[model samples]
Target chain A: MADTATASATGGSEPAIGRGLKGLLLVALPVFLVGWLIIYPIIAAIVSTLFVEATDGVQFSTASYRFFFSDPYSRANLALTLWTTGVCAVLLLLVGLPIALYLRFSTSRFADLVQSLAIFPMFVPSIILSYALIRTIGPNGTVDILLNAVGLPKIPSPYLTPWGPVIGLVWDNLPLTVLMLTAGLAGISNSAVEAARDVGAGPIRVFWHIILPRMGNSILVTISFTVLGIFSSFTLPYVLGPASPEMMGPFMLRTFNDLYDPLNAKTQAVISFVFCLFFGIFYVWSIARNQRSQSR
Target chain B: MNRREFLAAGSAVAAASALPSLALADDKTIQVYSGSDNNIIDFWNNTIIPAFQKANPGMKVKLVDAGDDNGLRAIADRALAALKSKADPQADVFENFDARLPAGGVEAGLWVTFSAENVPSYGKINRAAIDMPQQLPYRGSQVLLAYDKTKLDPKDAPKTWEQLVAWVKKNPGQFIYNRPDKGGSGGNFVRRAIHEVNGRDPSKFTIANFSADYAEKSLTPAWAVLKDMAPFLYEKGAYTSGNTQSIQLLSQGVVTMVPVWSDQVLQAMSQGVLPETTGLVQLTDLALCGGFSRLTVFSNGANKDAALKLADFLLTSEMQSAVITQIGGFPGVTWDNVAADLREKYKDVVPNSIPTFPGGDWNAAINDGWYRNVATGLARG
Candidate 1:
C-alpha cells in the first residue's frame, strides 16, 4: 500500500522523462518559443549594453552602466522606484490581510460581498483607475469639494506628487494581494484555531501561533509579486507621478523616445532587470521550497 | 485526426487567412499612412482620396491611419529596416511625417527629394515654409497665447515674451502650460523662453547644432527664468499633461490663459468645448514656434509614381483652399499662390513669420532639459 501510494504520488513510478520521444515532442515547441521570445531578447539587450562603438572600433565598455550609476537624476529615479515599490508592498499587505482574515473566518453572507469587493480592483484597468483617482483626490476634485462644504481646511492634493503613483499602485495591487493572502488563509483549518483556543490560548495567541506561520509562504509570494508589479508599472506612474524623479518605466521610455537616446534606454532597462533579479530569485526559491515541502 | 491530416488542415487555414491581404497588395494600390487627427483623416478618406481616385480611375489609394507619433515612428523604423534589407517598404506616402525621425534616415536617403521637375506644385510652395528638399510642406499652425476674453480684457493681453512673463507673475495661479515633452503648444512656449533668455535670437539654435555642453551653457539662464516663473503658474507650478488639458483648465475657469495651438483652439471653440469668448494673440517680439506639416514619398516604396501624384494633388489650389476652410490650418502655398478669396479671407490671421524650432537633437535636449531644470525645480505649495 505504501509503495502504491508513493508510486502514484511520484507519477506512476516512472522516471520523469520515461515517456521519452512523445514527451520531448510535446514540450519542444513551448521550450523553443520561450527561448526565442523571452530569453533571447533579454540576452540580446544585456549583451548590447556591454559593447560600445568607439572611435576606432566596437570595443567593450561599461560606460553606459557607469553613466547610469553616476548620474544623479538616474539614481534618483532608481531610488524612487525602489521606495515606491517598498511602500506599496507594505500598504498592500496592511490593507489586504485583515479583509482576507475576516473572509477566511467569517460565516456571514457579508463575507462573500467583502471578498468580491476586495477583488474588484482586478477588473479596473490602470488608466481608468488613474482617471478615477484624479477625480476623487485631485485638486478641486470631489474630496476637496466635500471638505470645503464641511468648512475644513483645504488639503494639498497628491496628484503630480510622489504620493500619486504610490496611491494608485497600492489600489491597483490590492486585489491580487488579497486573493493570494485569502488563499493562504484558507489552507489553515478552523479546527487548528479551535484546538489552540481550547488550550486557553486567546484569539491573538491563536492567530500568532496557529495562523501566521502557516501563511508565511503566501505573504512572501505576495510581497515578491507586488514588488515586481510596482517596480515596472508605467501607465499609473506616467499619468499620476511627477515629471522628474519618475519610476524606471517612464524613465526608460523618455530616454528612448523623448531624449532619443537608445543606448541609455537599453542601459536603464538592464539596470532595472538587475534590480528585479533579487525579487525574482526570492520568488523562485520560495516556490521551489514550497514544492519540496509539499512532496515531503 | 491523424497528425498528417491535422498538419494539412493547419497549413490550409493559414494560407486562406493570408490570401485576402496578398490579393490587396497590387500594383494599382498605394498605401498612404497618415498620423493626423480624425478631422484630417476624414479629410483624406472623404475628400482627398475620393477626389484623387476620381481623377485617376483604376488607381486605388489605401489610407492607413498611423494613429500618433509613436505609430509613425514604428512605421519609419519598418521603412529603415526595409531599406537595410533592400525590400519593398509597403508604405508609399507618409502624411505629417517629421523628417528628422528615425534618427539618420534623412541623411541615409530614405525619402525622395522634391523639386519643380518632379512635383510641379513644389515651385509654388512658400520658400519660408519649405524646411528641406525631402519634405513637401502642405499645411501649418502656430502656437499662440489663448486667453478667456470674457475674463481678461483683450487690451491687457500679452503681446511679447517679457510681457507674457510679467502677466503670468501679476496673476499668480491663473496661467499654465503643459509639460514640454507632452505637447507642442507648451514645447513652443519653452522654445520661446529659450529664445527670450538668449537675447531673443532664434538663430543660435539649429537642427544640427546640439551638444550636451552647448545645451548646458545656453539653457541654464532659460531654466532659471522658467523656474523663477513656476510659482506663479496654475496651482502653484502644476502643469497640465497635454494641450487639450491646458485648454480644459482654461475652460474650467481654473486658469485664465494658456499657450495653445491655433488650429486646436479654433476647433475647440467651434465645438463649444472652449467658449466663444476665447481669444488668441501672437507675441510681436518673436512669434512662437510654428511648423509646417510636410508629406514625404518613400524612396523605396513600390507605388512611388502614384504617391507622387497624390502629393502633387494635395497642393492644388482647390485642396489648399479646402485645407483652410475644412481643417482651420494656414495654407502651405504662399498667399499669392493660393486662391484670391482664401488669401482675402485669411488675411487677418496670416502670420508675419512663423519661427520654427529645429527638431532633431535640439528638440530632445530642450524637452529633457526643461524637465530637469524647469519642471523639477518647482517649489511644492
Candidate 2:
C-alpha cells in the first residue's frame, strides 16, 4: 500500500496541471448546477432579508432580523428549534448506540433481525410514521385503549406537545444513526478488543477506552446529521408539535403561508441556516479529519 | 445587419413562434383556476364544467386545480405580472379568489368589474352577499358550533356568546378549537371572540382598518378572554391543528364540542364519519363569521368573453341550487330565486346574517396574535 501510494503521488505530481483540468472539467456541470440550484437560492434568500422596501426605494435594513431577535414569540421558536435538535441528538445516540454495539458484537441469527429492526424506520415515510404515531399514542388512541383495559389511570398524551417531535424525530433518525455507528464500530479490529480483555478490562472499560475512542468520528457525524435533520424538520413537527413555541420549521411555514409575511419568513430561514452552520462545520471537519487520518 | 435591426428581427421571429399557441389559446378556451377542497374541485370537474360545456356548445372551460393557497398565490402573481406587461394572463377566471390578494390588484384593475349589463344574473344575486364589486359571490360556508347531542341537551345548548363562554368554563376539558392559522373555523371563532369583547360590532374591523397599534389595543381584551377559557379547552389548553382534527376529536369522544365549518360538518355527517347525534348551532347574539367564496376574472385574459359567460352561468338558479344540494353551500342568489323545495330543506341551516371578517392584514394579525397570546398558554421553559 505504501509503495503504491508513493508511486501514485509521484505520478500525480508529474501531470498535476493536466489532471487537475480534467478533474475540473468532470465536475464543472455538477458545480454549476449546485451553484445555480442550491447556493444561488440560499444567497438570494439571505440577501433579500437584508434589503427592506422603503418609501423611496429598497434600502439596506436589518429590521426583520431585529424583530426576529427581539420578538418574544420568534425568540421562543428559535430556542425551541435548538432545544428539540439537542434533545433529539442525545436521544438518537442513546437509543442507537446500544443496538449498533449489539449488532456489531453478536454472531447469533437474532443479530440480523436486530439489524433489520434498527434500520426499519428508514423505510417508513415520515407522513405514515406521523399517522401511525398518532394512532398509537394520541388522546384516546390505541395506547389509551390498552391502558384502559388494564384499569390504569389515563396518561397525558405526548401528541401536540413539545416532546411529540422529539419522539418522532428520534425514531425516524434511528436507522441512519445505527448505520453510521455500526460502520464506525466495524473499523475496530477484533484483536484490539481481545487485547483489552487480556489486560483485565471489563466490557464497560473496553467500551469506554477502546470502542468509544475509536468511534468518536462516527458519534460526531451522527450527532451533526441528527441535529441538522431535526432542526429543519417540518412534517413531524407540524403534525405533532404544540401550536405555539413551535420549532423553526413550522414557524417559518406559518409566517410565510398563513401570515403572508415573506420577509419575516426569510429572516427566520437565515437564522436557522446560521444555527445549522455550526453542526455543518462539525460534520465537514469530522469528514476532513477522517480523510487525513486515512491518508496518514 | 446593424445591432438594432438584428434585435428587431430576433423579436419578430420569437413573436412569430408564439403566435400559433396564442391563437390556439384564444379559440373559445377559458382557463379556470380553482383552489378549493376535493368536494368543490369535484363539483367543478364533474358537475359545473360539463353543464357549462353542454350549455355553451362552441366555448370550452379548462379547469386548472391550483393545489393550495401557495399554488393559488402563484397564479395570482402570474396575473399581476401579466397585468404589468399588458400580456394575456394564462388564467381567465380565479375561483375562490380573495379580492384583497395581489396587494391592490383590485385598485389596479387587474380583474374585471362585474355589473348587470355584463352578467345578467348579477341582478338576481343577493345584495347582502356582495362584499365587493370586483368579485362575483358564487357560494358560501359559515362557521358553526358543532356539539354531540348524546353529551349535551339540545335545550341547554348555549345560544349566545356569553352563554357559550359560561358553558365552556362550566364544562372543563369539553370544548376545543383548531389553531386559527390552520383553519377558517377556528379563525372565525377567534374573530367572533374579538367581536364579543369589542361590543359585538363587526363593522369596527374592516379590510383597511388593521394597524399594529390598533391590533395590540383591541386584541388585548380578546386575548384575555381566550386565555381565561384556555384551561377549559380539551386536553387542557391543547388545541387541534386544523378543522378536520377538531371534528375528529369530537367524534372520538375526547371532546364534546368544537367549532367547524357548516359544509364540512354536513358532508362528514353524510359520509357517516360523524354520528347522527352530532348537532350544529350558531350563536344567537351574533352569528359566527361566514364568507362568500368569490371569483374574479382577469381583465387581460385572452378568453375574457367566455370567462364572463362562465361567471354568469355560476349564478343561475340551476347551478346555484346544485351548489346548495350537491356541495352543501349557501347560494349566491337569494332564496326566492332558488328552487323552493331545496330552499325549504335548508331553511334551518341558512344564516340570517353573514358577518364577514376582513381578509387582508386583519387575517394575518389575528392568526399570529392567537398563536402568541392564546395557544402558548403552556409554553415550555
- Give candidate 1 regions above 4 Å deviation: A1-21, A149-154, A197-203, B13-21, B81-86, B100-108, B211-214, B338-350, B378-381
Docking class of 2: acceptable
In angstroms, give how far residue A255 of model 1 lies from its true place: 1.1
Model 2 Cα lDDT, one tens digit per residue, A23-142: 998899999999999899899998899987899999999999999899988988888888888888888899999999999999999999999998899999998898788778888888
Candidate 2 lDDT score at position B51:
98
lDDT of 2 at B60: 87
For model 2, the DockQ equals: 0.49
A-chain TM-score, model 2:
0.93
Give the alpha carbon lDDT tens digit for every residue of B1-381 in model 1.
888999999999999998865875666788888888887898888888898899989889998998887898899999999998987778888898877777789888899999988898888898878878999999988888899998899999998888999999999988989889888899899888888888888888876787889988888898899999998987677776678768866876668999998888878888998988998888998989887899989988988988899899989988888788877788888877678887887765667578887777787788788887777754341
The deviation in Å at residue A10 for candidate 2 is: 12
lDDT of 1 by residue, A112-209 (tens): 99888888999999999987887778767778879989999657878778888999999999989999999999989989899898889997888789
Report the Cα lDDT for residue A275, model 2. 88
State the lDDT of candidate 2 residue by residue for B277-353, as single tens digits: 99989898899998889998888888888899999999988999999888888888888889999988988787657
